[model samples]
Target chain A: MDEVSRKTFLLFGDSLTQRSFDEGGWGGRLASAYQRKADVIARGYSGYNTRWAAYTLEKIFTKGHVPPDLVTIFFGANDAALPDRLNGRQHVPIEEYVAHLRAFVEHIRSVGTKHIILITPPPVDETVRVQENQQKVGGEQEAAMLPERTNAVAGEYAKAVKQLGEELGIPVVDLWSNIQMQPLWQACLSDGLHFTSTGNAAVYHLVQAKINEALPHLRPDALSMDFPGHADIDASSPDSAFKGTAIS
Target chain B: MDEVSRKTFLLFGDSLTQRSFDEGGWGGRLASAYQRKADVIARGYSGYNTRWAAYTLEKIFTKGHVPPDLVTIFFGANDAALPDRLNGRQHVPIEEYVAHLRAFVEHIRSVGTKHIILITPPPVDETVRVQENQQKVGGEQEAAMLPERTNAVAGEYAKAVKQLGEELGIPVVDLWSNIQMQPLWQACLSDGLHFTSTGNAAVYHLVQAKINEALPHLRPDALSMDFPGHADIDASSPDSAFKGTAIS
Candidate 1:
């Protein structure tokens, strides 16, 4: 009984991660790119910060479970929430965020995962965020509420992520800096924080580039197809094609 | 340690199935629809007919491997190939196609999968197929090669699938008939056989409708969110939020 198991690429993070399968999302792009090579799994939890996510680690990567071949640890957007703001419930202090991220790497490694990539949170557009929030509130009170997240604060978290990645010798996708490199970076985000289609494309390209650079062997082109190609199978003796070592 | 295992929806079939993760593909749509509820796994083999797929049943659903909660068995397009044509290598007789489908149902059942949906091949456009084949072959000889598959032949395979589904008491997504009911059904397919964006949208809607009618319990709304919503968490004691039955 030969078992067929494709390589798994797990995405673990918050709403940004959870919504990665939306139309034209980075996760969907990855799934399309790695279609025949790997199974891209989304364990994204909307509105989750590292503190809350900490409890899910044990449950998500259970003991003796076959660890994912690759994992992208994307967080920090929600963690950068202002501690005094309306969305402060989702915030974790900078120090705690760094510590939680480090712990995540260690825990994932301990569970036998071989490849890990860290993605920093993108910059938040305060003006857009304020307007979006106002639309949600739909009243004069909307003006009373301040933007719960700021670009500068999110940048700090992004820097923290880059530093941690350097310390752990893991590749990092500095989403904040990358998206800003584009013209009219504000348009990259749908709301003040979440990604727009352009932002998703940027993430997809960066992730693909990082994979090619740091984990070349895991690239879709580098992996063997699970079965023989139709052209390779003999019409009269199709079963013969499956007899070879190709069906991995 | 609590283990977090989401329900799995496995898609098994040939090229049509394999390409379902494309930009506007049905598989991608389903992945989006079932975002946090279930993992949609695509075990799609391009250019595979039922005869060849029979060899993969054991490898894909091995002993002791947890069976997918829901399975979509979609095939027949390649199986309907005219045996004397260029694509004849993929042809399987109608009798064999039905027998193989029944075997697939039995094998899936033996593995403990509870929900199964069968999708017949969509209608083929012979004119477009011939032109597409000509573009591939090039030159004046393109005119010499007849379309490898005909709508009537594929329809036979589709009918076989419907019959098999009926005998097994499984629901069927009659794609052949459904697509034709749409305006300019030819536009639904990209290259006569494969799905266009419109066709993919059609598949996505039909599959969703089928799930609602035949397997309502598997609907995204019916499933519990794996983690608690952020609004439900206590700002003062975030840890308390994870203590309930919500962390399934």
Candidate 2:
């Protein structure tokens, strides 16, 4: 009945998090880096905002389950949608969004999660978003239609996340500004929202650096492999090499 | 203490399995396909053979833990190593390899695993392996050393795996023969042993096809999302959308 108790790193959020397993995605990169050391679990609900996330918080982080060692809470892109636009149904009032973020942290803490990282939504590309929406609607006639989301509005939500992280004393990856630091940052976004390979790489590097600074013990290199390396095994009597080893 | 229960798919094997989270790896592709439907857990131990895996089976699938819904047991690459070569420490006799494979299935079933898939050792390219080893040793004098593994030897182990699968009434992905079916299959391998992106894609497609044929209900499209999709939510009263949702 002995358990293989590798540490777990959970990613909780919306489509951004859901798509993190795509080729060259941040989540996949993290999983590769932590191979044999920990488990990276993805709990992403696409098209969800902080308000919707609030309703499923307890369900996803149920009390008795083994708590994740580290978690990244990434949200807010959908919450920043313009209230009167076509996608307004996905928007949450700025105040409620901030409150929901706080509640999520409190709930996760109550469930015994040890480390948490808050990632602000990456910068949006308004021009690209508008063009993409126009294409989706299928006509040049809709060219004049207003964009449902704007870079400025997303920036506001990203700022709230940063301020909350400071107030709560939690580490925050300021994705909003960090991504913009890259030359030609707009190219980082594929459809003005989600990431391109470059953007994913940027997020991976940022998160990795944050882990190195805030949770050095969780780094893959710093952790021991679940089992001994093959070179360390006793060739003549392999069982002896694993006889007293703790599976974890 | 309610738990968020998601179906689990476990991948157990050696280095090929260990590196399955790399960009374009079959494991990562599977995870992406099953996002929000199941948790794809990787328990890959590099340079491991059947004998080594036997010692950790119980520890990995402990009695009280929730059994994975599906498990893929992949091995034999290291087991096919020539006994008198530089990597002889990893070799397991063909008879013992087959016995160990059967034991793996029994041990997993004892712990309540529902579905099992076996992936045979992939074909080896002796010329490539020998040249690579020579480069590693950094000397022209080592060029005459025999390869630590041969395609013919690997094929025998693969055949044993297939025969074992039939005897146990389990589905098997005969990677050795399957990869050989590709046009210029040697290009599919990066190092004579490990896979290239093309090889990973091939593995992903083959396993996916097997899932469709034998475990249709476990396919990503056939399963329910852990939570309701955004469009299904009641925007006016968001909580209503999740009021009776099971969150699994």
- lDDT at A119, model 2: 97
Which parts of model 2 are misplaced by more than 4 Å?
A140-144, A244-248, B141-144, B244-248
The CAPRI-style docking tier of model 1 reads acceptable
Q: What is the per-residue lDDT of model 1 for residues A1-248, given as tens digits with 9 covering 90 to 100?
A: 12675788999999998988887888888988987678888989998888888878878876688888999999999999898765777889999999989988888888899999999999999988778777777646744268889999999999999999999999999999998999998888998788888888889999999999999999889988787777888878877988832121
lDDT of each: 0.86, 0.87
TM-scores, each model vs. reference: 0.95, 0.96
Count of backbone clashes, every candidate in sequence: 0, 0
User: Highest lDDT, which number?
Assistant: 2
lDDT by residue (B1-248, candidate 1, tens digit) is: 12665788999999888888877788888998988888887889999888888888888876677888999999999999888876777888999888888888888888888899999999999998888778877746744368889999888888888888888899999999999999899999999999988999999999999999999998889988787787888867766888832221
Q: Which stretches of candidate 1 lie over 4 Å from their true place?
A: A142-145, A244-248, B142-145, B244-248
Write candidate 2's Cα lDDT for B1-248 as tens digits: 22555788899999988899998899999999889887787999999998888878888888767788899999999999999876888999999899888888988898899799999999998888888878877546543377889999999999999999899999999999999999999988998999999999999999999998988998778998987899999888776778853221
List of chain A TM-scores, every candidate = 0.94, 0.94
